[model samples]
Target: METLYQQQARVFKALCDPKRLAILEQLRTGEKCACVLQQPLDLTQSGLSYHMKILCDSGLVESRQEGKWTHYRLSREGREAALDLLRQLTTPDAEAQSSGCACRRGRE
Candidate 1:
């Protein structure tokens, strides 16, 4: 089974690319067809497909097919999950997180 950190790492790794992040911003407006995305992104059909596959794999996006075209959108559950992971990273845990550093111990 995958560890929680590993799973979260996948989500971060998927978003490391600028194009992938741009795609997410585009989806925030609403669901969009693959054809509509290509012009603004300056990506070829296959190029967009490559990036979309990574986004979908990370569970940050979803896709549907209609006739010959594909539509894509941000996933609500995915956004929540990513935020929760970020919260965990930022939230304080005194003993559990301490390394006994003088400065860090002073904060507590």
Candidate 2:
């Protein structure tokens, strides 16, 4: 099994690319077919597929097939989880602040 940090890192890695961010923004309005995404993003079929795999694997996006086309959309639960993770990681902990660092104690 992947460690907690490893799992978290996947989401970060998925989001690190400019193309991926753009793709997410495109998805914000609603679902889009893979073909529709290709032109605006200026990606080839393979390029879009590559990024979509990352987004889907990260749980930030979901996909379905309709005839020859693939449709993509933001995963509501996954997006919420990603938001919660961001808030948790960035928010300061009161107890940690009170404890102080060992390096500070050593200086005195």
The per-model lDDT (C-alpha) reads 0.88, 0.93
Which candidate tops TM-score?
2
Per-residue lDDT of model 1, residues 1-108, tens digit only = 998778788789778999988888889899999998888999999999999988887889999999999999999998888888889888998878656788977888
Residue pairs with colliding backbones in model 2 are none
lDDT of 1 at 99: 64
TM-score of each: 0.81, 0.88
> Cα lDDT of model 1 overall?
0.88
Please list the residue runs of candidate 2 whose C-alpha ends up more than 4 Å from where it truly belongs after superposition. Answer: none
